[model samples]
Target: MENREESRLTSAELANLWRLYITENLMYQFKTPLIDNCQDPDIRSAIEFSRAISEHYIVSIENIFRNENYPVPTAYSENDIHPQAPALFTDVFCLHFIHQGAQLGMSKIHEMMAVAVRQDVWEVLNQGANDFKDLYQQSLQLLLTKGLYSRPAFLPPEKESRFAENKHYVSGWLGNQRPLNALEIMSIHNTIIQNGISKAILRAFAQVINDKKLRDYLEKGAETASDIMRELEDWLIMENTNVTATLDSEILPTETPPYSDKLMMMLIANVGVGSLGVYGNALSTVFRRDLGLKFMHLMKDAVQYAQEGLHLVIDKGWMEVPPQFPDINTR
Candidate 1:
């Protein structure tokens, strides 16, 4: 079934297209409702832009698939969006969601562009990356203007360049431990902020979702986020720094869901994987033994939760199979 055409899509190109197509579908499903219910002009504009970006990617990728004669995977449909539903999140919280989405989009674009080889495929993904970059900048500026953006804790100017002088810098488990360095502090602060936002999203989803099992699972995910945030907060408090704001007070009492349980579970799974990545990255940056151990524990819990969500996605048949190599066993 391999295409003999000179411009035929490579397996990597097909995989990237498929992955982003699924993501764009989720974007459409999530953003349409947000756009309809969004009250803040600034937030609405950003959501519109974000939604447009996804829509553009979807159309562009589908064209590539069409030209290549590969059947596009079935993704979310219009039925997935509930625009008439009451606002599940406040304007400020919605803005936060878009901002975080932009950040994650940029990260994903980098991953996608890395493996893309086809000229046409790389062009499309590169353009998508630039679009996300612009969206990230715009959303960030809007968040800052509205005073909703949480800036990382500032460190004092370094008086001089220095390097770790002792083995204790690598392992602080024994003897006298040094205060947390800027790198360690930055990791803790960033992780706590991410967990806070994730908790808010999970809390809102849990409140509106009807399926008892999914709702219960979403609540559990929120609790896990809260636990991790509390531990991170303690570390920040030890440094006498204030923690970032949580959006719990901002979530509305809307009993109706803006998205279906299936969509919600998919979002949960996506965010769970991102959370695990953040923890994994932080583990590498943390210098203290205790801090590294803490990240490991949090990562373990996040992985377990993500696996549960993925299993549900599979059981419900929401998990789309990605492009794969031909099976030699059958051959």
Candidate 2:
């Protein structure tokens, strides 16, 4: 056994310690929706696999911390779990979310592991990377088997021509006709509340992930989201708009995830589309350059999030295979 006092943690060790803290936080967040309302058998199985893997990683890291005589960060704990919260997603949505989360986690983990130095820590991270790869593969197979996946649609020649000719669309301005008002400010505040809820959910997931790399990525995202939320709230107060820090009571009750992955996919896709519309409108309506920039930033991040989700769908084979384009004649 490595001597507790003699096992000095290197910079690599310190980084991993922070990573473990963050991933564990995410795992805790994911567990609630998985246990309370996920309905699809296949998705539930995947969640079970993820939960198990995260738990193992957490234990391994904790052992390492103890052996090295380093104080473990208390970023994740039992308090993070929300077993009593009403189901927020149908089984289908739950599976889609899991797949998306896994893809994001994997991408971030790969980046982190590339920089890791400790042989033992690197080995553990590699194991996790492999597990997530397998999980992504399995998810694709399952989606293909169920005919739940679909490829992006190809635009017809006429449609493409029309889109190319259409120049009326504004790029950065708010699309709304009037200047910013109290009602519009209130609407923006609501958006902030929605964003906060999303952060809370992500924070929960962070609590359970074991990989240091994966945890750090989640923690960074959480921090970014929190910053945006604060900014939005401050803007609302500055405008003297009545805004509530909490979510409205009328938000739909959390439902069991649907069995169909397609529904879930559409739901998330629509959210991305909706954000584009909202941001576009804001650009046209709001005259302030700073506010417009903030909206653009939020929209850009949403696009990235949606793209990551789409990649998972494609990787898992839940979407339809794309048709090959005709090759140009070389002669």
Candidate 3:
């Protein structure tokens, strides 16, 4: 037996501990009621797959800890779904929310994996990261196949010639010429509420996420978003602005989600990633440097989520098929 005095935990060992910590936590969060409510079977499957992988990882990590004569890290504790709380959403919506959360988690993992000190740990992370990429791709495919994915509502004009004649540059760096109008104030308030909703979504995912590192990262993101929302509200109040903090409940589709639980979750991740650019541009247009800095942070988080979601999609062969190359020899 290895002595306790020795640094028994190698980089690989530590990495496994981190992996197991996240997976076990996730297993509890993704139970039958949660699974049953999912609209997409593919999404449900993916979650199950993730759970299985995590379980395997946990076992592997425990073995490593045992071999190294190190005490295994205690990560997962209880499967406590509070009795008092009402069900917040249907299974489909829950899956979708969780999927977005996973994207965020994967993104954080990719960055940390890049800077991992141990080669073995890096290798493990690299493989796991690729798995997430596959998952993302599969989710996208399911969305497309089911025709449930939401396309960007605002489409540019169809005729290229029509765009050539119209050119207008609107400038508002020093604030709008007129004092911020009611409409503009309302828009700002709407944005803040949207931000809050997104933060809540992240928090929900963090609760169910299997990875400790990912959970920690997501929790941090939720906190950061909450802070930004508070600041935005404060600014609105100072300007005597009327903020419409409530989300438009009628906007989101109420139709039963068409896909399986797993697939639906994947779809949600894709949508969330797709929305990042819009958020980035919106903030850039309306906010000053002080506010802009917070937006930048938000952008960073969005990019991370997008990258991870994309990785999952690609790995799963769910994205659009690449075009076939012409036969050079025949040509």
Candidate 4:
């Protein structure tokens, strides 16, 4: 048996660990201020729980990196944190962030775990997944108790299962479309919620950024988020479904940033890039011809905006170079 437990880190394990370290580091940075500024005790406790878990993961991965003789990624650090900065987001938003982040983290951990060859690596990823799953449950319970979470649109139980009657059922995102099936409804609700979060993040980042060009760029992104949400919500409306919560009020008026402008830009860019994947996945699942086309249109705009943000980050020298294989084909 190949003892992966003692084996050298494969490229996949290295890459996943690097990505997870950066992700956990970002969460820890945000969680510190969030925990300090949180009002409600329950929410504060939940965030504290999340922060603790994130710290554990951060230390774990750092140790692995050191053991492997791999220089740790300087993703974000104390340099990015502003000690005197006031609350940049509300308590509700903090809870929501933890809730959504934990939920997403579980999925991410599983993805990493799939690529992991080492037994030790699996253990770390597994533990991280379990920890975040608990946090997800905790944050969700609090959001439900506080009436903060917008429940997904209810799918009425079918009296009897039946096959699609005709081609009309494949009608798209607009016009006289048929009622949404389960996957379609889930896709719409998830996209709406994601855009809502994106809008709030952009608004909050726009408030603290000092660069006029960056601020203008963030504001435009926020507008794009609004446009995306509006179209997705229209789908819900057409199906007579419940829309997701608005996060505008969650953004605080603090002009002071908790994170550096560079950090915020990179973080927001990550969000934009991630959504493109979600849209692509949705395209494959959503049966409507026009609905797929709509995703194509939205994805095109998102790609452009993300490219613009990338240029700004590169210009500022804030973007870190990712680990890459040297181009041997140059010869």
* Candidate 3 per-residue lDDT over residues 198-298, each given as its tens digit: 66655655555454554565566667667767776776766765443422231233223222233323433534543474455556565244444555666
Q: For residues 1-331, write the lDDT of model 1, one tens digit per residue.
A: 4346756777777887898898888878888888898888888999999999999899999999888788888888888767679988888887887888788788888888887767778888888889889889989999889888887777788889989898888786777778788888888877987887889889999999888888888899899889888888888887777688888887889888889888888887777777877888899999899899999998888888888888878988888888787899999
Task: Report the C-alpha lDDT of model 2 over 214-292, residue by residue, as the tens digit.
Answer: 4454456567667777787777666455444432221335432311233234333433444455555555665455566
- Extract clashing residue pairs from model 4: none
**In candidate 3, residue 128 scores what lDDT?**
60
lDDT of each: 0.84, 0.55, 0.51, 0.85
* Candidate 4 ranges with C-alpha deviation above 4 Å: 1-6, 173-175, 327-331
Q: Predict model 2's lDDT versus the native.
A: 0.55
lDDT of 2 at 148: 46
Instruction: Score candidate 4 by TM-score against the native.
Output: 0.93
lDDT accuracy of residue 20 in candidate 3: 40
TM-score for each prediction? 0.94, 0.48, 0.46, 0.93
After superposition, candidate 3 runs with Cα above 4 Å error? 1-20, 31-33, 36-40, 77-88, 117-120, 146-173, 176-331
Better of 3 and 4 by TM-score: 4
Query: By TM-score, highest first, what's the ranking?
Result: 1, 4, 2, 3
Off by over 4 Å in 2: 1-8, 82-85, 147-150, 153-296, 299-331
